[model samples]
Target chain A: KDDTKKEIMKYYWTSLHTTLANYPSLPTLHERNTLYHYVISSASLFPCGDCSIVSQKLMRKYPPQIGSRKSALTWGCKIHRKFNEEFNLTVPTCDDIAASYIIGS
Target chain B: KDDTKKEIMKYYWTSLHTTLANYPSLPTLHERNTLYHYVISSASLFPCGDCSIVSQKLMRKYPPQIGSRKSALTWGCKIHRKFNEEFNLTVPTCDDIAASYIIGS
Candidate 1:
């Protein structure tokens, strides 16, 4: 568990750096890390596309079915990761992590 | 693929909201999702606990061997989530998502 905790911490921080790097403007370490925890542990709200990072794109496709405070409580952050051992699509960074929502199970 | 994409988007955005909930503040879905992609795909740098979301907590314990820009590029985000379908720690939201780094393989 010690090792797992260490590994978990390392993975979480690095993920934040990588997440902010895409914007060409890096977010503060605290900002990124805090946000990281929020999403990971957050509940699955409504659905993914309903509250995606790129919502406009999703809205264009489906507009009528989005938004609900109750659903918000159940949403979890969705970042896709594919490692050499995990998915073999190694690229140092995941393909894309559009901020989307996940409904609770 | 279309359905997968839809699912992915929804999951990402909702995650941000959940993440922000922890701070009693909310980050835009865009902010969270962008960060999500970075951590997901970034290479694992050094090891975890080196650059954790709660770094001060880590620095107190393990000092002297943290931070290496080269390693930075390889680090991935670390968020601990146990889904009912994925793991058994199902709790609407994940356990925690610390901003730690992952040393890429």
Candidate 2:
């Protein structure tokens, strides 16, 4: 179960980052709002109940930053850093995040 | 650009299927609504503009089915079948969708 959860999360996070990385550098207000809704909805509807709960709480504390592509990417990395800290995983630098998650960077 | 788009879409579809497969068999109204929002938001926000536009049109024609896990899975498979047909790819039966996408079935 734990392994399955990890694999699922891996795909989920990768897809999310890919979307953010490909976002327009200067998104329209509507686009920004749409992405914000997507992030919050994911927190509520993520497949893993425990993870969803955690994400919900975290989102309440620090909502998604969707003003621009760079801001969105940084926000995603920040939330991921928190998750990594909680799990005692290697913490990624912003550069590492860009290099790893952003395609054709 | 095309190859990158394909790779990104692969991850997006895998993550979406994983989420749907793991959705509660019988979800609350709120859960159902959340998933619907996620689907529509995904159609709007997917990184590939052309694909997102196509999905938006498809969604308008045949909205998501979120009543139950089974229904949701079937709806997802049906949409995928349409995309496959458009791309001249192999079509998957419902059983094939279950076998391939649903984990630990």
Candidate 3:
């Protein structure tokens, strides 16, 4: 169960980062709102109860930044880093979030 | 690029299905709304532009069913099957969505 949970989390984060990395550089207001809602929904509906709670709390502390692709990607990396810190995992650098997530970049 | 997109889609769908499988049997109105928004955001912000467009179209034709775990799971499976069919891939059976996505179920 634990392993599966970990695998699921990996998938979720990878997908999210990749999506953000590919987001429009000059997104419209509606597009930003949509991405914001996606972040909130992810925090609320994530499969792991404990992780969900933690994510919601973290979101409240640092809301998603969806103004642009760079902002969104940075925000995602920050959140992911915080999550890792909370669980005592090795923290990843936020500097290369786009490079890491973007395929064939 | 194609292979990477396929891998990302696989991850996104697996995460989505697993989350739906673990959803509350009798979800609160807020929970239902959250999941609904998640579905909408997914259709809108998915990394693959073509896939996202097709998903948005399908979602408009058949809006997500978030009334309960079973409803949500079945809806997810149906959408996934439809996506596969769109690409001429073998469609999966929806009968065992919960069993398939729910790890150790």
Q: Each model's interface RMSD (Å)?
A: 13.8, 1.8, 1.6
Ten residues in sequence with the least summed lDDT for candidate 2 chain B: B96-105
In the range B48-87, model 1's lDDT, one tens digit per residue, is 2222323333324333111332222122112223111232
DockQ for model 2 equals: 0.69
TM-score of the candidate numbered 3?
A: 0.93
Mark the regions of model 1 whose C-alpha exceeds 4 Å error after superposition. Answer: A26-105, B1-105
Deviating ranges (above 4 Å) for candidate 2: B103-105
Worst 10 residues of 1 chain B by lDDT: B69-78
User: In model 3, where do residues sit more than 4 Å from their true spots?
Assistant: A95-105, B95-104
| lDDT (C-alpha) at residue B79 in model 2 | 80
lDDT per residue as tens, model 3, B1-105:
788877767767877888888789999999999999999998899888888988898899889999999888888988988888887867778756555555535
lDDT of 3 at B86: 87
Candidate 2 at residue B75, lDDT? 88
Residue lDDT tens for model 2, B56-102: 88888889999988888888888877766766768888778767765
Q: Would you list the rank order by DockQ, best first?
A: 3, 2, 1
Cα error, candidate 1, residue A72 (Å): 25
DockQ of each: 0.04, 0.69, 0.73
